[model samples]
Target: MQFVCPQCHISYPATSQRLRCAECGGPLDVADRKRFDPAAINTEDHSLWRYRAMLSLPDGARVVSMGEGMTPLVEAGFAGQPIHFKLEYISPSGSFKDRGTTVLTTALKAWGVTRAADDSSGNAGASFAAYCARAGLAAEVFTPASASPAKLAQIAVFGARLNKVEGAREKATEALEAAAGGGLVYASHAWSPLTLEGTKTIAYEIWEQLGRGVPTCYVCPIGQGSLLLGAYRGFKDLLAAGLIAKLPRIIGVQSIACMPIVEALRQGLDRAAPVEKKLSVAEGISLARPIRDREILRAIRESGGDALAVSDDETLAAQRDLAQIGLYVEPTSAVVGAALKRLKVDGVTVAALTGSGLKSPPALR
Candidate 1:
């Protein structure tokens, strides 16, 4: 299997030291056009690493696991409303990002990489740091200055070098670029196919829980559009493998305050354009120009999915609603819950609870 660029169509070696396309520098995915196993189902392993054979990592690989898979897809009742929340915070990093870290960091460790660097709002940084620590590798995190302190602290606790950048995430990302001088791999959660590979496990679990069938609709917040992209590819794989008959219509929710991809989608643009970010509690879904923007939009459109934006206030209200139902999630996950009210669907729906609210801003409580 190999991954091709959504923008350039140039293929990159799957499971190689190389990630992005060298020609156009675009996002990559598995090359083979194969799908999931419909007839044969396996649920022996718990973490996202359970799909090891399909993954690019070496055989008998020593993976950095934190029991990050098989999270409960609990049905939630809030304000006389029916909703389902995927408790991703139950992962090792207190966020859904552990799925990706489990794959990326383990691959790095196996390849003899000693140090790494990445940028994130919170959950991803925490996930990377925890897994890298477990793998005995050094890590550095460059994050927006406005990012939640508690989230940054998680990376620090693991002894990862923490560099806070002022201004918007664009500025923070630039800071990481300026400071990076080779030797340290840019282990960006947004750029790591392994991380996305890890994320696909969520789809696998969801399909299994649904009696090995795809759901009617899948909703989640998109920052760099990792979760949505992962599920899209996973479900498509299942469809290709003849395990599932069809793919679920995906809905990617984002914060209106910093909605670049949403704006692009609304404008019918495939690539993500740069934008000035506005403050919001859902710090997780904040991205200006995601590398995989084109693929993200295509996934949504191909499945008749839509990308929508929600206000921070609406997100907080959704959070309160979920908390009432005993599902505590960060503002980003709440954003998904809020968008669900806006989507048109009439079947079993799943909204991935991307992170625990406890790790976000304290005012959320």
Candidate 2:
């Protein structure tokens, strides 16, 4: 597959290390969309690799796996209604970011990359570090100095060098980009199209768990919009294969403190504009400007979905509510619960719990 810019439509070889379009600076996507063939599934493989036929990895690429994906879809009551919760936090790295990290790491290994760098608040960094360690590659993670101590420790424990940027979360990304310019592979979960190749497996699993049927709606928290966009792409593949009757409505949740995508949708804009960043309990989804904002908005709109923002109070209350139901998740994941309450969606619905409560600071838990 080749890397294609959605905006300028510039094509680059799939082996190109550039993360964004050189002409328009837009995020890249895998140009050749693979058709999903259920017959091609490796049923014996319980991990995300079960859908390897649909993934966009190069031929003969060695997979870097840690038993990621195939998370449980637990049915529970929420707001007096039955809801299916996709427990993505039960991953090897304690967050859903592992899905993306695995594919990215595998590609890096195939490309003969020995060192990689990435920036994340916590979950992505930890996931990348763990996968890099598994792949025997040197890894460096740039994180905000104010990130959760537990997550910072997790990254460092994986033997990846940690660079704590002193300012905002974006500063951490800036630091990683500077290093990437110096020849380090930027295994960016947010910007790299290969990451989405891994993440799209979530939809495939969800489809399988639902008896090969699609849900009426799917909900998830959006930071860089990987999970949501990936799910959208996966379901679209199913639609193209005539496996599902139609695409599911995908609702993206964001913290009110930093809701660029929500605001962009509310204003009917094609792209998200920068918003004032504020401290939020759901630090994972507190991005002021998502790199894939336009693609995210397009996915939501195409799927007949809507974007919603919830307050920290609502998110915390939802966290407690989820814990009471035996589903403990981070504040970022709880935003879906809050949004669900507001939506009161009918028919079959699934909410993706992206991160584990164990990853949160003790006080938040």
Candidate 3:
């Protein structure tokens, strides 16, 4: 099993230490691997590693994890429609990226990497720092200078070096890449395929929660597109292995301030054109340039799914709705809840609350 570049057709072995496609310089992933066997489901354990057989990891690899999986699938409603909230903020670092970092960090450690560098809006860096700490790997994170101070502090608290860049969210990637030397592995959540491998567990858990049935639709907020792509790749594996009969239509929500993927879909382009970066309250999903842009758009398109945008006001209001129902989530996660009113479909839906709202900026609350 291996990861193939969407742009270059260059295939890298699943265990390749190199992250980007050697052929076209595009991002890569462990997407094309086989699916799970219901017969092999390890109901005994709870973390994302429960789906170990479904991933491309080596046998008996020491997984660097922080108990990031089995997040609650909360039942909620809006306009009398049934909705399920996949609360991911309950993760160790208070976001879904913990799932990815857990697996990616372990993989880096297995590759003999003692130091790594990457970038994020907030959660990814924190999660990576935590796992890297556990794995005894040095981590350096570059983030937008405008991120939540608390979130930035968490990175340092984890003993990871932090680089605060002056500019937009997109520039964070440039800075991190620039700083990454031959000795430092770029364990970038946006570029690393293994990171999303851990995220695929969300799909498996959703299936288990629904009595082994797929949700009618999954509305998620996309930043680097890890969650969306993970779910998409997970379902694809399941279908290939005859684990599930079909896949859900993936609906992604983006902030109006910087909805690059939405514009890409609307324009029928696989690649998301560049857009001016804006400081949105939902820092986690505020990417103007995603590394997996083409693959992400392909998932949105192939699933017969659509990309939608919601205003900052609407997202904040949904944060209150989540709190009322007893889920403290950040604005990025709340965007999925806010997107429910905007969805045209009428059926059982799952909106992944990407983060816990307690992390929202004080002014918004």
Candidate 4:
């Protein structure tokens, strides 16, 4: 397997720590074109590792896992419509990020990396910190100073050095990049292809749980678009294996406060457009510039998907509605619920509840 840039087709060794292509500065993807096979799945392992045959890792690498994956696909009611909510929050790190962190950490250990750095608004940082601790690697996380106290506490408790950078979310990423220059492995969820390798397992689980069929539509909150892109790739794998006829319509939700993807889609742009960043209750998806902007747009367009933005008030209302249904998720996850109300999508649809409400401020919860 090699790290290949989708934009410029530049290839790097699979074990290379470089996050993006030097030629084009685009995010890299694993160039392993291995197809998915249901018979090859390790039925005994319930975690994402069950799809070990499909993952792109060094041969014989030890999987650093905390039993993350196979989140319950619960069919619930939202706005008088029955929808399947993929509860990704019931994870080792209280968010969907554990899926990527597990695989990324395993890859880092395989590559002989002992120290790693990453940045996130909250969930991804906490998740990476926890996984690094499990792998006995020195971990440092850079997060926005305005990040939730609960999430910062989680990162600190895992024994990882936490750097709270003041200002915008991108400032935290800048801090992480500076540390990476000082010899720390950049285990970024947005830039690392291995992270997608882990997140694609979600599509496999959804297929397995849904009687080996694809859903009509899949909705999820998008920041860096890892979850959506990963699911799209997984479904593509299933399609290659002849297990499914077509990919599901993937709907990406963003906050109206910071909706670059939505604006780009509306304008038929090939990349995410620069927009005025505003403070949002859903801090997690408030990314002003996603690294994989072009790839995300392609995924949405190719799958006949759409991107939509919801207001903060609508997101909070959705949060309350989800809580009423016993699904307590962070405001970021609630964006999907708000999008669903707007789409009023019928038939078999899955909404990814990405993070736990416990990770948010107590007042929000």
Candidate 5:
């Protein structure tokens, strides 16, 4: 497998430390042309690494894992329609980001890279710090000052240098970008191809848990489009492997306060345009400008899907409603539930509950 520019199609060695295409400055993808076989599935290992055959790790590479994946897919009723919920908040760091963190950190270890820096709202920072600690790699996580206190505490507890950037999440990302040029490896979950490779396991697990059948729709909250891109790639892989007939309609949820992808889709734009973001309780998905905006918009359009935005009030109501049903999730994850209130699907419909309520904003608590 090699890193291939999604635009220019230029290939780079898998071990290359570069994040984007040098030739076109476009996003790079781990271009693994190898076809996956269902018969090669590791039945004994239930973790995300069980899909090792399809992952893009080098031979004899040491894995940095935390038994992530195999999250529960529970059936429930939402908006008077039968829907499913993938409980991703139960992971090691209380978010789905762990799946990517494990693979990205492990890949960094294999490349002999030690110090790493990343920018995140909250969940990604904590997840990265935890995995870096497990991998014996030094980490510095930059997060917005408005991030949840619990998340900041979690990052610090994991022994990572926590730098709180004032203003919006973009400020933190900019701070990390500048620091990364000064010898620190940028382990951006949004920019790293390896991170998406790890998140693709979510699609595989969902397929297996549903008796190898694809759902009618997959609803996910989009911040930097990490999970959205991962789901798209995973379902595409399944289609390529002849394991599924078609990709499920992927609905991307976002905060109305900051809905770049939603606006782009609604306006029929090929790329996302910057928006004026406001303070939102769903801080996890409050990205004014997503770096992979084009890729995310493309994935939604190709899957015959659409994007939705909900108010903070609706997200809070959905979070409480989910809690009433014994599924307590953070308000950011609750945006999917908020979106579900408007969706009327027939067949199986699944939405990812990405973060635990413990990491939610103080108002929700």
Candidate 6:
């Protein structure tokens, strides 16, 4: 498989070690979907690796996994309509980001990477740290100072070198990028196609759980949009394989405090302009400028999806409601819960509960 720029249509080999497009500086995506083999899926494995045939890792590569995937698909209700929920927070790292971290770290192991760096508000860093620890590689995770204490604690507990950036969330990313200059492979969940390789398995699992059928809508919260893009890519592969008749409409939910993607979609722009981000309880989805903004917007538009933003109050209320149902999720994950109320759902809908509520503030819990 090769990485291709969606905008420039330029291609590069998978082993090129380049993060972005060398020509146009755009985000790179894995366009070679010929490897996806639904018939060859490893049915015995209950984790994301069950779909290993579709990943970009080299043959016989060591997979760094913690059984992350195969989350439960349970029936639930939202706004007086029945819907399905992907309980992704039950992952090893307590968040859906583990799905991507496993694949990315496995690829790193294949490439003989000794050290890696990444930036996250919380969950991605913790997931990366845990996988890198399992892979016996050194990890340096940069996180914002305002990151949840639970997530920061998880990162440190995984024995990663934690660098806390004092300013905005973007500062952590900047710090990680600068550290990557020191020969550390940037195993970024947001920027790496390898990460998407893991996350896309969620779609495959959802397809199987639905009896190889496509849902009417797929909803989730967006920060850097890794999961959203992964879902889009996976469903695209399923459609190509004739396993599904159509793709689900991708609905992205963002906090009103940081709605760059929503604003970009609303304005019909190819890329998201920077927004003055406000402090939000749903800190996980408070990214100001997503690196994959164009790709994210394209996926939503292509799938006939729309983006929406909700207030902190709405997200908090969603969290409380979910807790009452015994499904404790972080406020960021609750963004999807809030969104389900506003969307006009005509058929089966599925929303991803991205992170566990244990990652939230103690007071909120």
lDDT of each: 0.78, 0.91, 0.81, 0.90, 0.89, 0.87
Runs off by more than 4 Å, candidate 2: 181-183
- What's the residue-level lDDT of 164 in candidate 5? 98
Structural similarity to truth (TM-score) of each candidate: 0.92, 0.98, 0.94, 0.97, 0.96, 0.96
Best candidate (score: lDDT): 2
Candidate 1, residue 216: lDDT: 85
- Give stretches of model 4 more than 4 Å off: 362-365
The Cα RMSD in angstroms, rounded to one decimal, for candidate 3 relative to the true structure is 2.0
Answer with 5 or 6, whichever has the higher TM-score. Answer: 5
Candidate 3 Cα deviation (angstroms), residue 245: 3.0
TM-score of 3: 0.94
* Residue 131, candidate 5: alpha-carbon lDDT: 96
The stretch of ten residues in a row with the least summed lDDT in candidate 4 is 356-365
- At residue 195, what lDDT does model 5 achieve? 89
Per-residue accuracy of model 5 over 1-365 as CA lDDT, tens digit each: 48889888898887636788999777788885445667777889988888887788865679998999999999988768888899999999999999999889888888888899888999999999999999999899999998889999999999999999998788998898888855588878878888888888899899999999889899999998899888998899899988899999999999999999989988999888999999898888888888889989999989999999999999989988888888899999999989999888868998999999988654734
Cα lDDT tens digits, model 4, 1-365, are 58888778878988747788899877888886568989999999989899988788876689999999999999988898999999999999999999999999998888889888899898999999999999999999999999999999999999999999999898888877777856688888888888889899999999999999989999999998889988998999999898999999989999999999999999999988778899998899998878888888998999999999999999999999999999999999999999988987867999999999998844844
lDDT of 6 by residue, 1-365 (tens): 57888778998877626789999887788776555677889999988888877777755688888888999999977678788999999999999999988888888888778988899999999998999899999999999998998999999999999999999988998887777755688877787878778888888999999998879999999998989988998899888887787889999999999999999988889999999999998899898888888888999999999999999999989888877777899999999889987877988899999999998854943
Which residue pairs collide in model 6, if any? none
Q: Candidate 5 — worst ten consecutive residues by lDDT sum?
A: 32-41
Residue pairs clashing in model 4 are none
The reply for model 5, stretches above 4 Å from the true place, is 181-183, 361-365
lDDT of 1 by residue, 1-365 (tens): 45677567777655535667788776666555434554434457766655766666744468787777889888766444465678888888788888888888877876677878888777788888888888888899988877887888888999899988888777766787677656787777777677778788788889877777778889888888788888988888788777777789898888888887788878998777888877787777777667788888889889988888899778878888777778888787889778876666667788898898878754733
